[model samples]
Target: MTGNGADRKTALVISAHAADFVWRCGGAIALHQARGYEVTVACLSFGERGESAKLWKQEGMTLEAVKSARRNEAEAAAKALDVHDIRFFDLGDYPLEMDRDAKFRLVDLIRAVQPNFMFSHSRFDPYNTDHMYATQIALETRMIAQAWGHNPSEKVLGAPQLYLFEPHQTEQMGWRPDVFLDISEVWDKKRAAIECMQGQEHLWTYYTNVAENRGNHFRRNSGGMAGGRPARYAEGFETVFPRTVDELG
Candidate 1:
């Protein structure tokens, strides 16, 4: 298929679980969408096997029931973020493994979107290997999509900036964020999105606190007591690719 207009900017986010995007980078998604970028979110799994505790606590909840409930919550969360295209691979989690075909499918999506930038989990996560594995797959798929001989008919992908969003436990995950985004303007939308994940309601306040802390970091880095814009909420990211630019702003 052909690519979109050159003026149109796009982005893709690969989440290990259905609700990972909301917690990790919902603010970035909302902020970019507001900036007129077409953002596509691809959730690798529903996290039914492990991530959904509230649903599992309920009586008589089958595997399918849990998956359905998680899917509903993720869809609601995506909607709250104004995300129009959100896909669930449903490959399973707690040990999320993707076969060759699944990798190819991801490659196709990457090539099709031709995103200017992308977001994925941290490279290392001991607590949840699924998160790191998803990033591994994302890197592999991105490489495959860039290969000219992989699929001659499809348009090859460009070298887009791959930004790793913050992990749950940054110290353990060794996730040092270099980019701090002030999402104060879109904090309300991100908060609404965070609330939509009913399965992980306990994390709502925790993530809110994270945003607030990151906001403080943003202010400190931008201009520590030197008249920087006061921010109420923020998100952080570590870029995997070196950003090329004519001038550093």
Candidate 2:
């Protein structure tokens, strides 16, 4: 948000599973990194319990093995996206439950990062409760981080816009995207990052198609059929907080 560009800006992404961020907003992460934002991705769980079907299909895959593989894949994906500050909550998935202490830990991270904006799952997802649960924690932690009485010494959080990335089934989840990001320049980076999630290799091409479709949406919204910027890949987001502007651009 700084115009001078001397100070470093930050953005936080809260992913329910290890591979969620890669599939949902890898382009956004890469694009923001190019824009000089220090993007931090926090995976709430390894998704071993529910999401790692490929790994589980193996003859004798243990929970520890699944967790290790997921962590490694997530680290590699983050690296591909130029994200250096990735954290694994290791909270366990299927039903990601965060206790009071866990919530406080997340709040501490929010205070430390003080991101300009945040990204998480849609508000509601019937197929995946873990995804919705992560967003709930995101909302709670953001509120706690902004509380004056939560911790007197720690820095309080500012009003950072929480953007819900597109869900797997947007229509069913009631996720309406109001903002479209032109990530055509970073599509290669995103595709590379998507490849890092080896456990979910099937999703690689699926998300590529998603980016292509979102690009069409971007062109349509930004002045379609006339003179819209030619974007080949894009990402969509639904803002949770009201954006304040000097004037309507």
Candidate 3:
């Protein structure tokens, strides 16, 4: 981490599906953009295969409809965060298995951008195969990005620090948030970002709850409400870097 807050930071946020980013890390993206960081969003799938309840049975909710709506939503959300680049791999939804080809494609993306930080779902999520698989792909892609022999397209950019975003179902694997980012200044932007996923408004209430919950954590730890946007709200992550205390201390 740089001491100067004005440093140009870059971040890549990967998710199993389109709406996942809105639910998981929309606020974080907004926060990054507010700090002048370049942000990239990559979705493994459009989430056409996920459970839709009665919404899918509605008049015009075909699989294509869902995918198109998600694309538009992601676009609006990215714009709210000042993110210029958004990539969709169009992998199969619900169960996003990182086949050999898919893995290589993701690795190529990482090599191309070389973000300073990478955020994705946790591999410990057991209920969602797509989420778990997306994390697996991210993990493998991180390794491949640094490998000298593989991925000829990439010029061996050093590995970015990987962080696991808090999952929707946090109790399952238990989210241990080591880092809490105060995104109070961008909460409205974040809310608008989440509202971009109109197809999942009903499903996104869980995320609002999450933001409020994480906000309380931020307040408790930081000692007061801060930032330029709202009184509270944050995106939390667990750093996967294995380092000695000396490196941090």
Candidate lDDT (C-alpha), each: 0.93, 0.91, 0.77
Q: What is the lDDT of residue 90 in candidate 2?
A: 94
Q: Which lDDT tens digits does candidate 1 get at residues 142-192?
A: 999999999899888878888999999999998989999999999999999
In model 3, the clashing pairs are 185-229
Count of clashes in candidate 3: 1
Question: How many collisions between residues are there in candidate 2?
Answer: 0
Report lDDT (Cα) of residue 109, candidate 2.
89
Q: Which residue pairs of candidate 2 clash?
A: none
Question: In model 1, what are the clashing residue pairs, if there are any?
Answer: none
Q: What tens digits encode model 3's per-residue C-alpha lDDT throughout 1-249? A: 311134546788888887777777887787777777778889888887684444486886778777777788788888876775889999877667768888888888877667878889876887887787788788888887788889565478575777889887788966688888877788888888877777677766777777888877877776554533334678888887753344552
100-219, model 2: which lDDT tens digit per residue? 999999998888888988999999999999999999999999999989999988878888889999999888999999999999999989999998888988888889999999999999
Query: What does the lDDT come to for candidate 1?
Result: 0.93
**Residue 94's C-alpha lDDT in candidate 1?**
89
